[model samples]
Target: MPKKSLLMIGVFLLATTIWAALPRVSNPSPDYQTQPTNDGSHVEKIRAVWPGPNPEDRVRARVVMSGEDIIFEDGPTSQVMNTHSIRKSLLSLIYGIAIDQGLIDLEATLQELGIDENIPLTNQEKSATVRNLLMYRSGIYLPAAGEHDSQITDRPAREEHEPGEYFFANNFDANALGTIFIQETGYELGPFMEEFLATPLGLQDFDANNVIMGDPWFWPSQDTRHLQYYVYMSARDLARIGAMVAQDGQWGGRKVIPKDWIELITAPHSDLEESHVPNHLYSHFGFQWWFQEETGTVWANGYGEHFLMVDPTHDLVLVERNFSGNSLLSTARWLSSGNKFSGSLWELIDTHAMLVKISDS
Candidate 1:
């Protein structure tokens, strides 16, 4: 054999060995046998329109439900992936329960709650109430864990507005809510969610142990005062959450979340003009939820295309998950790209269009 050919063969063998040695995380095979009745036509229509033409909008799983019946499901619906900012909406639900139990007071001021930060909060900033945090109107701007660069850049100056006087999609408010919940309720977020929210809704793929405190892979050195409480949930499990909300917080005839709490959280607290969300489709902001009153729909959106949409008018719930894979290479690429690797606006628009069509049918 020629020397060049032998060298090429040796190089190929070495590359193959290295590739085989790399650790891989695999999504569990979907259990098709136990999957609910799926409408083939609906699934096909969704596939044709959703995720759009963006290469970054890699949708990993989707599940659509009408009432208690799952009408469509695709990909690994059982695989638990990061829920990202949807954790905020989950926290809202937990707050509802805590408030009902008299464990948390919405009107309690941050000063009274002892919510001090590393940089120190102003007296005016400390006057913000728990309800203000839930509405993202806390008006305290500080570096927060799990925040994107755009969010940080767009954040209003510290003490720009008094508490409850303005609206901004602030991660500081959400993360602080996590702190307040733990302090007032004396229950860690994960176990409390698993008990009060997950188990009640019959979530099949939720594990309290898997809940993360911060994005260790990306923002490892974020402020320790208020770390983001990240939740991991399967598409199917998220669908269950959407279903309960769609049913006015009722799950199988039992009131899982208080009806008044549901009504209050879904009500439009901040108008589009005030909230300044980039998406025109969402007309208002509720307590950690986006509201489209025209369609009578509420949404919980997370980074990288994770969504939980509830349409009470049609009794429909839709969940979409985009897992960017857990490989070190993927994480490295995400970090290298300034942590801007997220789902496209076009994809979200397309998803909304598809949902409208499916609901109409």
Candidate 2:
């Protein structure tokens, strides 16, 4: 055979090997207890607030909690799907654990981490720290997978705010965090998530096999690149995470993460910057988690109305998964267009408000 044919054969075998290794649900349909008696009034309220004539058209899954138990749930709680940026919240969880294990130093600078690109980082950008990335204040301004172009356009000139003075919800921040994780620990995101998080939380659906890089094309062709990644988790497992957060990193009487770290990350760090996302009720961010002051609810929000909300005051954890109006690629383009999204903008607002009412009830 010609050398080129041999090369093609090698490539085909490599692709097939990787595909075989990817995680699949051995038991996709498991016996999940459904709480028919759990108060669904809040879900009904959300249905009323949603735009579509039929609520089922908008919401794909929901999980409501009272303390550690699932009080109510409707829709496809067992169905696994991409929750978009909610993966950031999981990254945040990993960060807390990483920090506690002394694998990462929040105070460490980019220069110290040896973090640099082929495109040279300005001196000011090099001065950023892990904390700055967590706060979305690095101001490094690299093109990230899920970021809107308008955000890039609106961003201050390079080095405008030093490291911590400005706040923008750029995918670069999260991607850089992923890079830092691998650099510090020598583990890719998937395995790290499985060993440290899924195992500890007793999650039924999450594992290294199911996790995939969030933006495969962002740093494509770069041999030394560390790509950002995301996880596909079911509503029930998402609630497990929420319940853990509500319990200050404890699950089933075990301390899954340091309680102090949980407090530090969920506490308000900076006010959210203005964006095309119109109906966000959150005012501040903490370690990638959003903080709503009026309701004392800390949440992990994703594109297209994915939410995992924790209200400690009422011992409630809620997870909502709804249809993304467009495909991920199309949604990325829509966001880049600088036009506001109309269809699902209100879901976050309505969900938060309803959670408050649920707690009050």
Candidate 3:
């Protein structure tokens, strides 16, 4: 054989050997699964800090990437935990679908939707529209259905700012959005989510049993408009949701959500630093997703450090959850206060830097 041909054959053999040495990932769900590689170095930094010194940081967490890569996971990734505000992001996806189908209108005012309460709303509050709620700019502070007392206590006064003029991470927005979905579709959130999202995404562990509905006692009004609900899901399932968003609503080659709607929701609408958010690495809020300005990534965040982030630039989905199920009150208090915990601030900054480094590496 010619010398050049022999050299080319040797190169091919070497490449094949290297490829064969790489690990393979299995996927029982529609999301792609790829084996962890040197790409997990950044994730290792996260794992090293897991169950950190603080009581608050000593919690469960799981991380996954696009292609369903098990980047870094600790504790039980399959354990269903209260998603808290992370539920809002899932709710946002439902809203996008509802709007795309013309089942709900973003411009529909609370009054037009017949979303009234036993306690009369100020005209400004009444003027709040679905769009305002999605933006967290409703400025309407009527007690939320599923919110705990701590959340309610933290809320601003009713109609504290004109509609479209303020941003507060109030549960009322999500609950009200839930009400709109039911009123318009004649289907409850659990069933609807299971059918449209969970089922389609091939979620491994989601069911009606995991659903937490609005507590009548916690609500400000008897009206269903004040009703709210939340879903508890596993980290892997949340990562699937993140992957779907990262892919612009496409999952397994299917258009699960409209691209335009995804763009609209992920686009920055409110600046959180301007809103006086403390220790906030991310500065902007999209529809329900939070935008990390530094990384150009968007995430669904919850109390207790539950997060599912999507970096479209790298086609990556990362998730971490601190299961507050065992210590709800303590966790809630810590999260609501926005205080630093277990070197989280430093770890978060380091993780972001590491991801960038790894991606560039």
Candidate 3: clashing pairs of residues: 32-67, 33-67
Go through the candidates in order and give the C-alpha RMSD of each one to the true structure: 6.0, 6.4, 17.5
Worst 10 residues of 3 by lDDT: 23-32
TM-score of each: 0.82, 0.77, 0.76
**Candidate no. 2 TM-score:** 0.77
Shift in Å, residue 95, candidate 2: 0.9
Question: Against the true structure, whose TM-score is highest?
Answer: 1
lDDT tens digits by residue: candidate 1, 267-313: 88898776546767788999999998776789998877677888887
Clashing pairs in 2: 214-229
For model 3 the TM-score comes to 0.76
Q: Against the unseen true structure, what C-alpha lDDT does each candidate score?
A: 0.78, 0.72, 0.71
lDDT of 2: 0.72
Model 2, clash count?
1
How are the candidates ranked when ordered by TM-score, highest leading?
Answer: 1, 2, 3
Comparing 1 and 3 by lDDT, which wins?
1
For candidate 3, write residues 224-255 as lDDT tens digits: 45666657787777888888888888877888
